[model samples]
Target: MELDFPKRKIIHVDMDAFYASVEQYDNPDLKGKPIAVGGGSKRGVVSAASYEARKFGVRSAMAGYIAKKNCPDLIFVRPRFDRYKEVSNQVRDIFFEYTDLVEPLSLDEAYLDVTQNKKGNPSATLIAKEIRKKILDKTGLTASAGISINKFIAKVASDYNKPNGQKTVNPEEVIPFLEALDIRKFYGVGKVTAEKMYKLGIFTGLDLKKKPLEFLDQHFGKSGSYYYHVVRGIHTSEVKPHRIPKSVGAERTFSENLSSEVFMLEKLDSIAGELERRLQKSKIAGKTITLKIKYSDFTLQTRSKTIPYFISNKELILETAKELLYQSELQDSVRLLGISLANLNTEKKKAAEKESVSVQLKIEF
Candidate 1:
């Protein structure tokens, strides 16, 4: 049985240094200086860093004090989420001008399918340039784009030229491009996965392609098959216009660790309240309530319970979290507490049956 693969023109547009750039654009004093957004307090974690700060090893998720140590003059600014959302909406509006097949990955990035765009332009590369320019013109900030046959490659290509640039992997160049790519550069392969691939002597796309399907499956389980397909440039996931969320959650990291249950209960109640507000905003409910605890030593723990009925109230969320908290004795002083709801009441699609594609259709660039 022979099957044909659909050819798609996908573009991934990512805002360059979004939070830090926004800060810089809003305040003239911070432009071209090493700056980080968020992570100013002793316990705060850096959310984003400008390219200037990145030069000194200041990175997102790093401890605030450590970022300060790396770049002594680094200015840390508080994040204005409302302002960022306003800018994000403006950029999203530009994308809608070209196609309604836009899938937002975050406030700063999205995937667009412009195979038959409104502009009637056949060139995806040109469309990417137009989108980036419009974003800059409207927001006074720059964006980078990648145009290719699918989302994965487009996402990978978008990072080739940082700050403000674009890369287009033509249809004919997809396979060779994948073959020459460094295994670590693959979008889904993180640090741990790359190290594992190195141990297996799969250092490049060609090395990955050399392994048989069974050998890959034996070692990587389900992911092995994904590696096998992606290395050959055969991604089929569509650009969804409305991506459904899997869960709703909220968390807080305390400035000081709490040892007593009395102190922790107050924190739990507040955390549950935040979680309830998030669920309410989304107009969703769930049956599974999870409690997350992060100890002062940095070790993490989670406990969950699945009730028969859905719930979206603070009282029920707090009650469940408290039960999970006392289920076991405290191992050490806790520095963070969180509440999350999963198994949401949303229209989740069932997994599609896999089919074999034997025919490789020619795609014109």
Candidate 2:
């Protein structure tokens, strides 16, 4: 069966060792050293690590003690979330200058739909290169980018080169590229899934492509359908722009519910910070702020206020959330405290204008 859709130009940009790189970029002394960002305490975990640390078998999510053991000279630094968020916003603004079809996956990565771009540059590869240069110039950091015709391929291609690099998989190269990739490198195929594929003799993309669709479905269930299309170099996911958020809220179920206002406020402050960070990353401001409270007895109540102008300030979010917490009638020990930002600014122009000239050329032909 032939699938019909417009040929697109997609690019994925990923910052290299985002948090750790930021630290090194700011402190010249830290350059080329094995560095890990996170807790230095015994119970702390590594949130990000530099390439130097990765060389010594240290990685993120590993305990600080273990990471230290892995690299005797490893340097551990505490996470400065606020600073990281600031850098993330700067990188995103750079993306907007190229094309508006930017879909951020996290503070460190995003996808751009550059089928139609502001500069009218015909080569997506050149655009990717320009973006990398701009990022280095603005943030003093490095990023890797992948350019392809779809999200799946773009995402995979971005990782082909690391630290500071760019890779492209033109349409004609897609089939051979997919066929040669190891099964484990396929998106969404983790350790457990790879083991299952190994048992089924699916060791490469070519092996995966040969499997009957029904057989894949029987083994992998719903996700099997996705694997079927991916192996054939087909992906239809759009580069969804960051726009009006459907829901703006944060929630945390405590390890133990307590009546202490101090503890509740501390949790609320963290949640409020996250909301502000997300808002800034999305380049959106919200007018409505909602506070959600869940009692130990499982009852829930929400209070919200709509402001005249959109707000993305961290202080405002925290202050409004605290006020809502105080306004609610506390009938029982609180088990969950949540905050959300809603009713976001949606008037910003979408990225990537339609190709009027290209359409005209097609009509004339």
Candidate 3:
């Protein structure tokens, strides 16, 4: 059965090294130099790395000490989240000018459905270029864009030209594009999945497409079906304007391994406070509270409970975390502690329909 649906015009806009760029833009001395937004301390992790730092193999989520080793002159700047948020809002405002169907993946990137845009612009390629230009004019920062018929291809295409560029995968090009794409280049296929695909002889989209639906399903379970359809240029995910988060969480890694539950209370308290602040900021609550523990050896464990009523206050969150902590004994010295709330009080959006794959003439919306 062929998958088919309305050929919507989707654009994925991703800011280039957003946090690092923001730091450079605000401080002239930092521009064109190797800089990381965070990871100055012993336990620090790099939040973002400038292109200069990336040349030396420094990357976000890498250890600070390693980043420093990679780029000896790498300057570590403390993150100014408030300033970044301000700039992110400015960029998002530009998106709102084009379409109301905007789905923010993070502060750095978003997916836009301009099938029926406010400007009545029919060419998604042109709209993507305009958006990137406006973002640069407004914020003095560059962004990359991917334009295509669906979110999956758009998202993958957006990464094709990094730093500052755009790529478009038109309806006619979608299939051949996917077939030639490296399996690692598929948006949702991560490092582990890519390795697994390699072992399965699925080195490219063509290899993935060659597998029967039953073979994929038998090997990859539910995700196998998704792979089968997406390779055929069928991804029906709609651009959600109000993307509700599945969970709100906060976590902390200690400089030293904490041996006792008593020693962890303070850290857990701080994490709960942060989680509460985030929940309050979003003006949402959840019935499920989860406590995550990472041992010194790096093994992780989680404990969760579902209360009848939703709670977003620190007192309640901390209370539940403590209870969960006491429910089980320590397997090893703790390295990180976290608290999260799920089962949020938000209505879920419905998925798009997949109908006939009859080749209808492409209509520019």
* Among all candidates shown, the one with the greatest lDDT: 3
Residue 149 Cα positional deviation in candidate 3, in Å, after optimal superposition: 0.8
TM-score of each: 0.88, 0.69, 0.87
Candidate 3 lDDT trough over 10 residues, lowest sum? 356-365
The segments of candidate 3 whose C-alpha lies over 4 angstroms from its true place after superposition are: 1-3, 273-288, 295-332, 347-365
Tell me the tens digit of each residue's lDDT in model 2 across 309-356.
889888998888888878856888987888888877765556675321
Better of 1 and 2 by TM-score: 1
Choose 2 or 3, whichever is better by TM-score.
3
Candidate 1 residues 1-365, lDDT tens each?
33334478899999999999999999999999999998677788899999999999999988898899999999999999999999999999999999999999999999999989999998898999999999989999999999988899999999988879999988667778889999999999998899999999999999999999999999989998899988988788889999987888999899899997789999999989998888899899999999999887778899999999999999999999999999999889998899999999985777788644433345433
Q: Which candidate model has the greater lDDT, 1 or 2?
A: 1
Q: Give lDDT tens digits, candidate 3, residues 111-212.
A: 999988999888999999999999999999999999988899999999999979999987777889999999999988898889989999999999999999
Worst 10 residues of 1 by lDDT: 356-365
Alpha carbon deviation, residue 362, candidate 3 (Å): 3.7
- Candidate 1 clashing pairs, residues 3+ apart or interchain: none
How would you order the candidates by lDDT, starting with the best? 3, 1, 2
Show how many residue pairs clash in every candidate, following the order shown: 0, 3, 0
